[model samples]
Target: MFGRSKDSTAPADQAPALTEEPLGTVELPGGKGRPTPKRKTAEAANRRPLVPQDRKAAAKEARAAQRAERDRQYAAMQTGDEKYMPAKDKGPVRRYIRQYVDARWSLGELFLPVAIVMLLLNMLLTSVSPELAFLGLVVLYLFIIAMVVDVVIMWRRLRKKLAAKFGDAGQQRGLMMYAVTRVFQIRRARLPKPQVKHGDYPE
Candidate 1:
């Protein structure tokens, strides 16, 4: 029975050899030789030089042309025998006087509006009470007196300044007095005019 029994698996003594074959050579679109790179020539490396001499000459010519134009203008003026007067150079004193006058004028211009606004405010407050109304009236009167005093003071100061600047000419003084009186329109005695013509009036 033992001899007839199936043979138990016997271990193989030799292992199988692996057969490896090299892969087929890949064919590129072109030949296997590497492509040659393009080389730059000396002529290609050399660039044209941009000289700015022409541009500089053009600028110089422009300046000369402008000078010629100015000279021509002066020559034309001379040929025409035109009399040119330069603007007056104001001295410090004159500048100060002008500035002072302008400031005073500006103050005068603002005075009326400011006074009116104050009066309106006073009136608004007066509407609340009779005492306030009376007080407002008194304040308004005081304000008006102050304004008159200020104007008189300014006029006197201006007159003094003018006198200092220009010595008193009797005629000028008289004219100035007339002008002041006219400007203020204050009640005064009748004055005679240097030039007056009596003409017959048609009835």
Candidate 2:
């Protein structure tokens, strides 16, 4: 028949051929190349105990660490190392002040020992002689006044020198108190121990 070609017409009972293609996976750039970990698995891997299992051992280790730190700081203070110095003792100005104070002799340094001797004498004399005990008290008062006077004189001179050198920074707040406290402390006992000797003032 001239109605249609044999290839163009399908048999009534036969099925049509599939026209769709098979799907393939697409690879993305910077892929992890592995499956993502589950939440529980990730959490477990990251978890750490808040408290240490060995309490005593942990405490001991902490104390040892603290002691080592203290020793390091102490040595730094002794050697006048700025990096390890406490905030109050740090800086060039404080260093200069320390040197200036160290170079001079303050009445306050001897005040402690002298006061102790005076107290002992007053105690002993109180029972033996009232007049002498009174005299000891008077002497102690006079010594204290002398210490005050010496500190005032030192500060007046040091202030002028500091102004001439460091300008405004040399006269920073609390520096006078810092110098005063240093003058009272024994030469060997001062922290950031004296870098200069007698008559070796900072220029």
The candidate that wins on lDDT is 2
Q: For candidate 2, what is the TM-score? A: 0.73
Which tens-of-lDDT digit does each residue in 1-203 have in candidate 1? Answer: 45643434434544465766433344457757443333555455674556665888978989999888767555543343223211221233333333343334323334455567767877788768768867777876776677667667766776666567655531243433433333332112112111112222111
**Candidate 2 segments exceeding 4 Å error:** 1-49
Instruction: Give me the runs in candidate 1 sitting further than 4 Å from their true place.
Output: 1-98, 104-110, 169-203
RMSD of 2: 7.0
Checking candidate 2 for backbone clashes, the offending pairs are none
Q: Which 10-residue window in model 1 sums to the lowest lDDT?
A: 186-195
Error at 133, model 1, angstroms: 2.3
What tens digits encode model 2's per-residue C-alpha lDDT throughout 1-203? 56788766877657676767433333356775456678999999999999999999999999999998889888999888888777888888888899999999889778888999999999999999999999999999999999999999999999999999899999789999999998888788888888899888788
In the order shown, the candidates' Cα RMSDs to the true structure are 31.6, 7.0
lDDT of candidates 1 onward, in order: 0.47, 0.88
